[model samples]
Target: MDELRRALQTRIEAGTLPGAVAAVASSDGRARVDALGVTEFGGEVPMRRGTPFRITSMTKPMVAAVAMMLVEDGTLTLDAPVESWLPELAGRRVLRRLDAALADTVPAQRPILVEDLLTFRLGHGLLLGPESDYPVAAAGRALDLTLAEPFPRTPYAPDEWLRRFASLPLMYQPGARWAYSTGTLLLGVLLSRASGVPLDDLLRDRLFTPLGMTSTGFTLTPSTAAQLPAHYQAGERQDLSPPSLWTQRPPFPDGSAGLASTVDDVLAFGRFLLSAGADLLTPSSVQAMTTNHLTGPQIESAGILLDGSGWGYGMSVTVRPDDISGPGRYGWDGGYGTSWCNDPATGRVCVLLTQVSDIFWNGTMPEFLHLALRCNVPA
Candidate 1:
């Protein structure tokens, strides 16, 4: 564990990373937390355990957890269609081809299911097609239908954003393929409409509160806001610059990317996931969530995102043992630099938070995962 701490410190001293906060915990609640580097590149504030990280797409798991809670409570069902809640998605269309024109579409065979949203297979995504005429791609970008893929988040209020999203045709039939980001955002709306409450409030009552994760939320309270560091976007030369205004709350709390939390907050949730949802979620639901639900071309569609793992509801469930961890080790990374892993096999939980984007693919994440894995679980 000391080696892990020193290695992270070495990165900070080398100026490769601005700041990081990491923690490793076991079943009994004992934890080892290490903080390294300044809050901003050359700023005076030191990184602390309480530092609120932007935690981007990592928001999916907690938001997914909220949806599952409703599922368990009988307010929502996994395989059931979400059309009842948000009428915008009731009668959907699918493109005949990936590059097909919007008008050249077919009627959806079935409504998008709750399971489809949970599994990220509900047919819409940030396709980023270079052909600017692609209506779905054009509409997504013009309406700001995403958050923090490349940063400077989507600016639309949730209702208008949903309206714009509803106007776009599905990239594929419901449950046909796995797409990035959009299904999760839509799931946020699904949870809100089905629960008849805001997503944040549902998350607060069902997840954040029970987990004792005080610093985790879509909106930053002043106290937690103060702990937030200047977020940086990594340049080609490794120069870290503050990307955009992240200090204030956004108009819509994007379930896929809009979240701010601490290492402890992440770890607490990680531990719950390891504990198969602890008291908040059913073990069966957790089991289903951590199980690999994507198959066939879906894996191919995911490209390298799965990285030889499987997609559980909100996080990546390890399907096969890798160098750092084994099958059943589940969790995901944030678009802004933060990642967590829960190894049910070894009873280990690791939470690592930083301020760079796409930290999962970079050597930095795997390097830290190795170190954290090396730590003997706290007695």
Candidate 2:
């Protein structure tokens, strides 16, 4: 734990980041938790284990778990088309070319399956590189889909957001390739519609409550808001103030990137995954959620977003491990300075949270993750 604290403290002293909170547990029932540095670079408040963070894409795995619960209850099926629940997506169109106008398209080869959203294969998402400036991206921007970061909260409600999204053509045919972000957001709306409940309430009832992740949710209440630190970036003084967008319930409760949570809450969720759902989910369901579901060609097409990992339900599976990690380590990183992974082989669960978005790209995140992986399980 000294080594871990030293690593994080060095970064803080060097002005690389403000502060961080981390939690880890191993198969032998050993565990450790630590909080280091201040809430912000020069802020008075110190980082704490319970500090809430806007977890961005880390929300995916949790929503995926909820979907699995619905599946187990017979409310949804992996193979069934999602059109019955999200009629806006019933007749999707594919762009003839990414550069082509939105009107130039072919009908989808098949309706999108529930599994497509889980696996990010629904074919509609943020385009990367030059394709991001293509017609699809332009259409998304026109609709204010706000797929990428540095975004204000979207004003449209879930239904309207879906309607705007469905107006555009998909970049590829259904299940053709992995597209990031959009599928998970759409999945949130689908879940709400199918269950006849709002997404926030549904998630609380199904996942957060059961997992004891009381601090994890779409909106930060008065209690949790007090725990939210000021968000920061590498060069920027402040990315988001404490009482920011997260304090209010966004019109769209995006399952892809809408939740704020604490290190302990995220650790609880990771522990649940490590425990193979801890009786909340069947072993087979947990296996499906964590297993690599992408084919070789699909993985190749996903490129940098997936790097070498394979997409599972809504998280990345470590198909290709490095020196610090082994295969079957499943989890996702949040764009907003947080990461969570459960190593099934070693039975280790790790959660690292900070308010600094720069860490996600500035090498600090990778350094912390490696340290967390190597840190001894304190007896």
Candidate with maximal lDDT:
2
Candidate 2 on 1-379: residue-level lDDT in tens?
Answer: 6788888889889988778888878866678988888877678888887788888889999999999999999999999999989888888889998888889999999999999999999888777766445978876887887776524667899989988988888888999889898889889999999999999999999999988888888888776677687776666766443565666777888788888888878888888888778878998999999999999998888888888889899999988777659788889998777888988877888888886778867887778778878778779
lDDT by residue for model 1 (212-268), tens: 998887777666576677665553322222323444666777889888889888988
Model 1 TM-score relative to the real fold: 0.93
- Residue 334, candidate 2: Cα error in Å is 0.6
lDDT (CA) per prediction: 0.79, 0.85
C-alpha lDDT of candidate 1 relative to the true structure: 0.79
* Weakest lDDT window of 10 consecutive positions for candidate 1: 235-244
Task: Kindly state the number of residue pairs that clash in model 2.
Answer: 0
Report the poorest 10 consecutive residues by lDDT, candidate 2.
Answer: 237-246
Model 1 ranges with Cα > 4 A deviation: 128-133, 147-151, 236-249
Q: Candidate 1: lDDT of 255? A: 89
Question: Model 2: which residue pairs collide?
Answer: none
